[model samples]
Target: MITAENLTKRYGAKTAVDDVSFTVRPGQVTGFLGPNGAGKSTTMRMIVGLDRPTSGHTTVGGTDYRHLKAPLREVGVLLDAKAVHTGRSARSHLRAMAATHGIPARRVDEVIELTGLTSVAGKRAGKFSLGMGQRLGIASALLGDPHTLILDEPVNGLDPEGVRWVRQFVRYLAAEGRTVLLSSHLMSEMSQTADQVIVLGRGKVLADAPLSELVRSWTTSQVRVRSPRAAELADRIAGDGVTVTSAGAGLLDVAGLPADRIGDVAAAHGIPLHELTPTTGSLEEAYLALTGESVEYKTKEIA
Candidate 1:
């Protein structure tokens, strides 16, 4: 597990990360989400001891990363995939990293196969594609078979298949009672993979909760109803706090009423209903709502 208590970071006169605190528990995939310049990278760097915190502290498994006797075996981190040496082969890179911690050569082979880099294991790191480099980085992270994994944009340049593989792989790791802290801009994939999420905005903790709770809190649920008597149904359901809006021909988007209640009302009024589907707010919607004001680099909509 990873724990941060009032973690803060400052570069010169500018504050990169404010006082932030959150726990990444074991047996779960905790997603780290935020907009650009929100201090996510700073926070992660502090967690792995790449940058010293100005105040407070963070720990991996109850100890600072620098204090861990075997840091690789305690926590695995992949902050940048492109930080590898260009002259080294993928296999050579992993072997070198493993050698630092006295990890055997067999573990390097295991991770190479595990990351599906077997075919290009002998190829130079500079010759590898973006996706291949990402795989190599992940292989290095898994080299020590650590209990905690911290990945930053692991799927940044992956194809659809590679994306799916990473999604499944992280979930599997979490299921094995390991702690996984993942950061990504892909909300759809994070929604499917993460059990809980910790959102940061402008170096401060904006929200931290389960994915479902976060969505429900930030956005509303809507029920789509299609019926021949759409107008009548809308009128029937219209009351305090309840809203119904027409959606083309025979459809209506409803709010503040449950599906079963709407169905009962339709049945009572003898309204012929074709469809009544409840649509909860998506993770993307919730994320936008939460981080809308936190976006540092705003782009104007094209006219």
Candidate 2:
């Protein structure tokens, strides 16, 4: 398991990560989410000892990363896929990384096959495509067969098939009682892969909870209604704190009111209703609601 206790990082007068604390348990996938400049990468670097924390601490299996005797065997990290030697072949790169940990050549071959890089194993790293590069990085991370995995945007350049493979791979690893900490901008994928989510905004921990809880707590419910007298029904139901929009012919998208309430109002107005369906908010909606104000870069909406 991995744990960060009141972790903080600062550079010069600016603080990159601020008093963040979260635990990543074994046998589950934990997602780390944040906007640009929200310190997600800084926090991951601190966990792997690539960057020093200004205060507090992070531990992998009760020991700090720097203090681990065999760090690669205990924790595997894939922060940047491009942080490899361009002159080396894919096989050479993995072999070199394995050599540092005294890992066997058989293990190197295993990871290459496991990540589906067997065909390009002999190709130069610089000649690989973005998806191929990511696969190589994953192979390197799994070379040591570590108990904990930390991946940052593993699907950044992957196609649908590659992305699905990663999702299944991480789930399989976690099922074997390993710890997985994943960071990505893809909310839809995270919703499917992660059991829990930790959200960071402006260097602070905005939310840390189960994925289901995050969705249930942050999202608002809406009701979709279709009726011949949609406009008349909308006019009758529209009231304090409630909004009804004309979606199309004979269709109204109603918010700030429940389906049953809308039905009651329609029945009272003697309006014939064709359909009334409640819609639950998606992960993207929940994320937007949580990080609405924390977004570092704002764009003017088109009117």
The CA lDDT of each predicted structure is 0.95, 0.93
lDDT, candidate 1, residue 209? 99
Q: Tens digit of lDDT per residue, candidate 1, span 1-303?
A: 999999999999988899999999999999999998999999999999999999999999999999999888888899999999999999999999998999999999999999999999999999999999999999988999999999999998899998999999999999999999999999999999999999999899999999999999999999999999999999999999998989989999999999999999999999999999999999999999999988888899899
- Model 2: per-residue lDDT, tens digit, 24-126? 9999999999999999999999999999999999999999999998888988899999999999999999999988989999999999999889899999999
* Candidate 2 residue pairs in clash (backbone atoms < 3 Å): none
RMSD of 1: 0.8
Tell me each candidate's TM-score.
0.98, 0.92
Q: List the residue pairs that clash in candidate 1.
A: none
Residue-pair clash count for candidate 2: 0
lDDT score, candidate 1, position 103: 97
Please list the residue runs of candidate 1 whose C-alpha ends up more than 4 Å from where it truly belongs after superposition.
none
